[model samples]
Target chain A: MKIKADTTVCIGAGMCALTLPEVFDQSEDEGTVVLLRETAPEGQEEAVRRAVTLCPSGAISAS
Target chain B: MSDLTLPMTRQRPFDPPDEAAELRQRASMHRLTYADGHVGWLVTGYAEARAVLAHPGFSNLAEKMHPPIPSRLDLVEERSRRGVPRGFFLRTDPPEHTRYRKLLTGQFTVRRMKALEPRIHEITNSCLDDMEAAGGPADLVEAFALPIPSLVICELLGVPYEDRGQFQEDSKLLVNLETKADDVIAALGRVTAYLHGLIQRKRKEPADDLLSGLIEGGELDDEELTGVGFLLLVAGHETTANMLGLGTYALLTNPDQLAAMRDDPSVVDNGVEELLRYLSIIHLGPFRVATEDVEIAGNLIKEGEMVGVHVPVANRDPSRFPDGDRLDLARPTGGHLAFGHGIHQCLGQQLARAEMRIAYPALLRRLPGLRLAVTPEEVPMRSDMTIYGVHRLPVTW
Candidate 1:
């Protein structure tokens, strides 16, 4: 699955980073979501999905 | 129209008022009568609570909002008239709220908060050491629960820990539902003035702290800085302190859960989330008003009508959390509304989480025989405060 993040709408609640740190990191400057990888790694799809669902601002998604 | 008032009294200290569950069972949203005679909607179901909080149609603007209970009506009207103080973004909608929230988000990122874990541990250990020195049968609220977060926030804001006596009293008055409007205003004035003076001092001598960082950002003026400082100071300490106090009370009462956490350190992260969900310390959910006509949970809410997300009830919505009333530390507790949702979600949530994750485990390890000194019924509760927690948790190890 490919991941997408829109930093403009991200409030930086950091659910994505907290839930799946391997796939997501927060920018030090603005604390917006910084996708560490464009695609979910094998066996980590469920966690990537969880991260997207937990994103409070709907700033992250996976397809 | 139902005549049920908001914030029904809790018959059991650990549970939300029984009326809330009954209301949720009837429907996700119900007609709510506010203290000011304005009939509004109360979102009781977990889905509806999330919907209202995340919906753009709902606004947190002071003019559009109403307090769920009667006691806060005067304060609400006063704030609406004067307008929300600059940098107090909690009462404003985007892009206004966006502006203020953005200025502070970087300071509270997951990584930034994680980096503070060591310091949080140090603080927790220090409090535990003090508690040990004091001997058993102490008021945990005064010894352990209150100091950890109070000291953490104080050091973060560059505020003198010596002045905690003043701010803690002022914060207590600000949160109490029974505090008179005049007294509430006086408390607010004192906190603002104190923060304003601190900001001026920081201007002359910048320090290595969040307040100094904000001042260095140069985005906000003196009034705005004071507003920001006021929010962090009051919110930072009280909320987490209650969670620690009440959370310990919960674990102590449930020996199995306490043992589970104490035995297996792996459960600490999810355990903290479960405690947050179980306690749901902020009893009165964030209040919002419909900026335009909106439908929530198949119910049509008219424009300009107020809505309160009864969070304690919403968190306990069985549809979202099966056996919601039970405090199982291993429960999958993601997406709970304890810190709220959407852009207005708690800015200091990561920091709060860091504090709890470190504090709870350290506390349990330090006091292996920890249990309540007073009988369950004797412990005082902060039922009258905006944040629900124990007033005094007498405990012994």
Candidate 2:
């Protein structure tokens, strides 16, 4: 699965980073979503989906 | 249209009000009657709640909204007053809300909150130590649940923990639905003045804390700084305190669920989310007014009309959460709106989570013999208050 994170819309609740740190990190200054990788690693697709669902702002999406 | 009034009676302590659940079953959105005879919309379904919260057509401005219950009318008026003190962004809509919220977002990021986990552990263990020393037949609410978050927030904001007694009482009055308008104003005044004094002191002698950090940022004026401090101080403690106390009661009663958490260390993360969803402590959901005509879940909410989301009901919607009534700790509670949803979703949620993640497990591990000292029915519920939870949880370990 491929992930996309929009920092502009991200309110920085940090669900993505908390859910899957390897794939998602928050910027230190603004705390907006910082996508570490575009594609989910093997066996981590489920968690990536969960992160996208959990994001309060709908700033994260996966395809 | 439903005849049911908002803030329906809770038949069971752990479940949402029966009337609310029934309303949800009938439809996601209902034309709810407010206490003052104002006909408004109530969103009960999980998807509906999420939509209303996420929708930009809704306004959080307190002046435009009506309270679902009569008692809260005073609160709405007090919050909606002209020139709502700067930094009180919860009641304001973007770009004003956006400006205030963004200033603090970085402070509560996932990494920063995780970094504070160690401090949270320390605070939790210390509270547990005090509870143990005092012996088992203590009110867990007073001894454990309240202090863990209280102290954590105090330390984080650089507010002296010794002053908790003053702020705690003031905060109680502010959140109590029954508090009179005059009393609410008094409480708000006292807390704001206290924060203003503290901010002045911090200016003279800067400290290493969030409040000090804000001062260093040089963004907010004195009044705004006081407003921000007031929000953090009150929001930081009361919500989490109720969660910790009420969550413990939930665990002790549901031994199977508690055991699952204790037996497996990994369940703590999911367990916290499940507890948040199950309890859904914020009985009164966020109130909003339609900025323009909007249709949600086949229901039309017109401009200038009010909308109240019944969070407890929405979180338990059968469509979103199968076996919605059950308290299953292992359930994948990813999308729960316990902290709410959308831009105004709780600013302090990450910190609250870090505290709970450390607290519940520590309590279970430290007090294996913990159980209720009084009957569950005897525990005083905060049904009269804005935030729902036990007022006092008497427990004996």
Candidate 3:
């Protein structure tokens, strides 16, 4: 399954981008939050879940 | 326990019932000493909760005492020696509180709150977009809950929103008891010092924001201006951070409530109110010392005894909110103590409400089927902390 990130919740602690750079990136201007994935990679479902689960702000989710 | 003198009897800063049942089972209230024998009262009943909060006998200034301009004051002596005002009005009574509060009031008027709705919506949507593109289950706290208000409050105050990441780190240290008091105090000194500079700049170039307006008016002294800015940042960020975590936890756990809001977007307003009341994340508010000997709920409080009005209990009081346990979107009241009451009520409440109202509906609609990826039992809750919330609220749609 693919997902879209909930960026408003991002404190830009930069943990998600650090953990999964391929799928997530921090915004250059605001250092707010940015997501490279319009949808998750086919085999990366568990890793994506880990990114969501580990978020301290509870900002991200999957659809 | 010994009848220890309240080393810091000072001024600072809710409840109810089937509340009777809940009160009976409440996380037992105790009159304990904090950080060196500061004697304060703790009330858990909903009715008395409001009464104590609104009570006049309580004092807010900690470093100052009555009659005993002794060689040493209590909790606040060091801070005052360093020239910090007794503390934020979150610890004050009117008319002094009135003076400090007035400088910041124009920012929280209902009309002002109403105006922020659109901007709050803009911030909320931006955050929702970031979360959506991440793909799969994610920690709602790190990803969405914390930043939404960080963006909203920073924008409202005209602080660089991006700086929150670093400010948040310093904030954690500032609020952490385990951190060296000196280091934490130093962090606070830095944040306030920076805010003072920002307020100075705002005076020269007024923006259409609260900080600039407050600074340009020249009503708040440099000390109060510094203090207010810090309060806004700490209170602004800390409380809402918990609200986002706990509110989402409530929704994710209560599938029916989630579905109801999902089906009808308009319910978001009431849902937000109920969540604020129910969660009441900022559990222990400012400590108020008894300036004069006073009595609360039949207990004779001696002069200089420390006490605080716990909000979760007050907001949950049955008199103020009947059927308090159920999270009803339809119910409304005189107000929720969640933002607090009277002169010292939260100045940033409107901003907090605006952020929640916008965030919840946008989140629900965009991620229509949002649900907990983990069972409620598996999810970690922050029981040890005074603010009731989870470390993370893992969700998926």
Can you give the DockQ of every candidate in the order shown?
A: 0.84, 0.77, 0.01
Docking category for candidate 1?
high
- After superposing candidate 2, which stretches have Cα over 4 Å from the reference? none
Flag the better candidate by DockQ, 2 or 3. 2
Residues B184-259 of candidate 2: C-alpha lDDT, one tens digit per residue:
8888899999999999999999999989999999999999999889888989878999999999999998999999
Pitting candidate 1 against candidate 3, the one with the higher TM-score is 1
List the TM values for chain B, per candidate. Answer: 0.98, 0.97, 0.83
Q: How well is candidate 1 docked (DockQ)?
A: 0.84
Which tens-of-lDDT digit does each residue in B174-212 have in candidate 3? 554345546756787788778888877877788987677
Which of the CAPRI classes, incorrect, acceptable, medium or high, describes model 2?
A: medium
Clashing pairs in 2: none
Q: Model 1 segments beyond 4 Å from truth?
A: none
Who is ahead in DockQ, 1 or 2? 1
Q: Sort the predicted structures by DockQ, highest score first.
A: 1, 2, 3
Q: Judged by DockQ relative to the true structure, which candidate is superior, 1 or 3? A: 1
In model 3, the Cα lDDT at residue B201 comes to 81
